[model samples]
Target: EPEVTQTPSHQVTQMGQEVILRCVPISNHLYFYWYRQILGQKVEFLVSFYNNEISEKSEIFDDQFSVERPDGSNFTLKIRSTKLEDSAMYFCASSLLPTGSEAFFGQGTRLTVV
Candidate 1:
């Protein structure tokens, strides 16, 4: 079966640098999303993209973060300016349903900001 793959299971970054976490989503899905979970917080949705443009974004998706589908199979999330508070497990998910679908997640990209 196909699955979403994320690189760098763990990442450590300085407080002001940039970080790009990569993901290869399942081959046949139509909707893609990025969500983050702080060490002790709830999973929060950052943004969702479809049709090569942003379909929806949550408040946490501020100017410092951006996402792109650089090609047909890969999706990427870029943080322009990392902050200590940005340390969290970033998850890439895909689903066939626009909303309320069960999403499958990668093990996760654990970003540690210092």
Candidate 2:
């Protein structure tokens, strides 16, 4: 089965720096999303994209965060500046439908901002 793949399973960066987390979602899926878990916290939705546009986004996805589908097969999340509180396990997910469907998630990129 096809699955989402993320680069650099673990990333360590200094505060105030920038980081771009890359992902390759399932090819046939129509909806893509970015989610994050801050250590022991529950998964929080960051943003959702469809048709190459942002369909939805949470307050957490402020001006500092951006998502892009640079190509047909790649989806990426970029944090313009890193903060200590931004450390978390960021997950990339995709679903065939907008709702009521299973979303496949990648192993996640563990981002640690020092």
Candidate 3:
């Protein structure tokens, strides 16, 4: 079985710094998404991408953030500026079907800002 992979399993950044979280979503999938979970909170959707454009996004994916698939294989999330509240475990998920299909998720990248 194949799975999504994220680099730097954990990251530590300064409050005002920039961070780019990287992920390689499942191959041959049609939809890809980024979701995050605050330390003790439920997982929440951040953004969804398909066909080289953003298909959907949550409020949390404000101007401060952006997502792009620079290459066909890697999906990246960039935070222009980091904040204490931005710290969370970010997950990358992909599915062949747009909806109603099982989404495969990466282990998650834990971001810590201080």
Candidate 4:
């Protein structure tokens, strides 16, 4: 089965540098989302995209964050100014469904801000 894939399994960045995490969601999926886990914290939703536009976004998706689909299969999340607290495991998920449907997650891109 097709699955979501993320790059940079681990990343270390200065406190104020820019970062871009990449992902390739399932081929037939209709909904895409970004979620993060801060160490032992619970997984939190950052944003959701569908039809090439943002469908939903959490407060965590502040001005410093942005997302894009640069190609047919790649989805990317960019942080313009990374902060120390931004250190976390960012996961990409996709589903050919709505909010109530089950979603599949990528291994994740670990971003460590120093």
Best by lDDT: 2
Give per-residue CA lDDT, model 4, range 1-114, as digits (tens): 788999989999998899999999999998999999999999999999998999999999999999999888999999999999999999999998966888999999999999
Better of 3 and 4 by TM-score: 3
Candidate 3 segments whose C-alpha is farther than 4 A from its true place: none
Worst 10 residues of 3 by lDDT: 25-34
Write model 3 residue lDDT over 1-114, tens digit each, in one string: 899999769999999899999999989898999999999999999999999999999999999999999998999999999999999999999999989999999999999999
> How well does each candidate superpose onto the true structure, as a TM-score?
0.95, 0.98, 0.98, 0.97
Q: Where does model 2 exceed 4 Å of error?
A: none
lDDT of each: 0.92, 0.97, 0.95, 0.95
| Backbone clashes counted, model 4 | 0
Model 1 agreement with the true structure over 1-114: per-residue lDDT tens digits: 888999889999999999999999888888999999999899999999998999999998999999999999999999999999999999999887687777778778999999
Q: Report residue 86 deviation for candidate 3 (angstroms).
A: 0.4
Candidate 3, residue 82: Cα displacement in angstroms equals 0.5
Location of the lowest summed lDDT over 10 successive residues in candidate 2: 1-10
TM-score of 1: 0.95
